[model samples]
Target: MRYSILTLATQALQKQQRWPQIIAPEKLKPHYDIIIVGAGGHGLATAYYLSHNHDINDVLVIDSSWIGGGNTARNTTIVRSDYLLPASFALKNFALQLWDSLSQALNFNLMYSPRGYLDLAHSDGELEHFMLRANAMCLGGASASILTNSQIAEKIPALNLDQQSRFPIRGALFQAEGGVVRHDAVAWGFARKSSEKGVHIQQNCAVNKLLTSNGRISGVSTHRGKISANSVLVAAAGGSERLMANAGVPLPMEPINVQAFVTEPIKPVLDHVVNYNAGLSYLSQSDKGELVMGGATDGYLSTARRGSFARLEDTMMRAAQIFPFISNLRLMRHWSGTADIPMDGNAIVGRTEIENLFVNCGWGYAGFKATPAVGWKLAELIADGKLPEMLKPFALSRFTDGALIDDAGIGPYPWLH
Candidate 1:
């Protein structure tokens, strides 16, 4: 059912008991043209675009848990495309363009707000780097500007800009089109639209093993039953490594825990998403008035979705150095999510050695922003059997060829990415 004022009023008059389910809990089909693993934003979006754009409706999306129950629901929603690399900027900028009109396309309210994003620089060297990045972003058709220290102070009066601080404010790279979106709404909107278009979404269905016939994918053995598919796409986020490994494909990525916390709702103060270069922390004020914040990944790698107090303390200390008022607020809650960080700090997308099986993973911390582009590209690859030029840079062969697309330019260190 389309959500609108008339539907809401009708439901209210009926005592709100007669409302349609967002997505039908359909039974597992015996066969499909394509099967996508993980019902998060990426997989659901892929299914949606496959049916809506490519006219391929015989698709099935299977997940172990409820939709959006994994990293999709645990992200601090920030979207931008101010990257130093050409391919990264293009993909993220494309996703941002999709986010701009996603609500209208899906006929669902996604709550996407394009309220600017600012990355702070603590020194002259950092400012110089940002100036170069801003130029590159503008050349690539993305809006970016350099803001001086005085301009930053004028924009954010509550920020601590004293020289006495450990990391004094210098300047920043600002993107007027960067912003955030409602994370859960993105998943639900895609799922609802895809289900309406004759796609099957099966929840609580775990893939036990991958079935291959003559070195090509034939089907998948799930908890529910065996399902056949001509093509299989693995868009699982943290579970990508294991899912691929089960299919005899080893990935050079590791799962790491990332944590985020929020403060009690207060009057609106922060007007834009803020990132501190030296502190390794980023924050933005949610529409509900809570101060949503997060920090760097843990030093070690693990799939456990819980962080140590030491990391939390370090993040709080750095946040206080930038926003002094944080000390007065009470912590509401904190949570963690698992991310698959590639060795070169870049995403891995495209075909694997196994023909008929495609993988889209290694997104690390940027998967939320790249959802739409990843889906669009993966759908194109599956439907046409040809990789797009934009995604060729991220193919698995890049690692073997030593043509890594390291966005940070920090070499092949996974943690730094």
Candidate 2:
């Protein structure tokens, strides 16, 4: 059902029980034109774009678990495009543009809030580095500006601005277009629209191995049965490495655990997403008034979905340093997601060594923000048999050709990325 003001009134009058399911479970198909392994945000969004944008509806999205129950459900929900590199800036900026109208296009309320983003710097040198990034963002046609310490103080009065404090606020990089969205809503919206457009979504069906008939394309062997497809895309995030390895193509990516959590509800105290660059932590406030926050990855290699309280304590300490009020709030919930960190910090998003196989992992913590753009471009790549220009920089062959787009200058260290 299409949601609107009238639909709300009508449903209210009928006791609100007539609303239909967002997406219906589908039986395994014998074959499909395209098969996407992983029904997370990128997978579902790709299915929707394939049917909606490219008129290719014969697509199957299979997941071992329920849709959006993977990394899609385990994120801090922050979105932004203030990247320093040109290639990274273009892709993310395109995603940000799509985000402005996605809720309406999908006929679902994403609860997107353009509440701005503040990257706090602790020293003059750090502020200068942010200025370079801001310049790059503006060059790519994205909005960004520098904020002095006084400006940040006026903007976020709840922040701890004591000059004597360690890592005191010196300045920040502010972007008006960066903010948060309802993460689950993004997955559900795409799944609903994709299902409505005749795309098959099979949940609880794991793709165990990649079945290639020759040096070219073939199909996948799922838990249910063998399903043939003309092409396959492994956008499975953490699972991409294993699935691609089944095709004899080892991915230059490693899965690492990243954690995030929220605090007890309170009256609104934060209006913008704040990143403590010095402390390597970020935070924002949800609609329900919960302070959503996170820090760096686990700094090790692991695929486990659970997080250690030790890391959570470290993140909480960082948050308390900047937003002292958080020290008084009780922890409501905490969880971790497996991040597929590529050799280079940039995402890998193009064809693999296998003829008909493509990859779209290595997004790390930035996957949630790049969902729409990746979907739109990956669908174009499959339907048109040519990679979109925006995604060429993320090709898997870049590593072999020494064309690595290392946006973070973090080298090929997956754990550091």
How high is each candidate's TM-score?
A: 0.98, 0.97
- What is the C-alpha lDDT profile of model 1 across 267-363, one tens digit per residue? 9899898998895889999989999998988856877888878778888888888999999998899998788999887889999999999988888
lDDT of 2 by residue, 57-135 (tens): 9999989999879888889999999888888889889999999999999999998899999999899998899999999
Q: What is the TM-score (0 to 1) of candidate 2?
A: 0.97
Which runs in model 2 stand beyond 4 Å of their true positions? none
lDDT of 2 at 341: 89
C-alpha lDDT values of all predictions = 0.89, 0.89
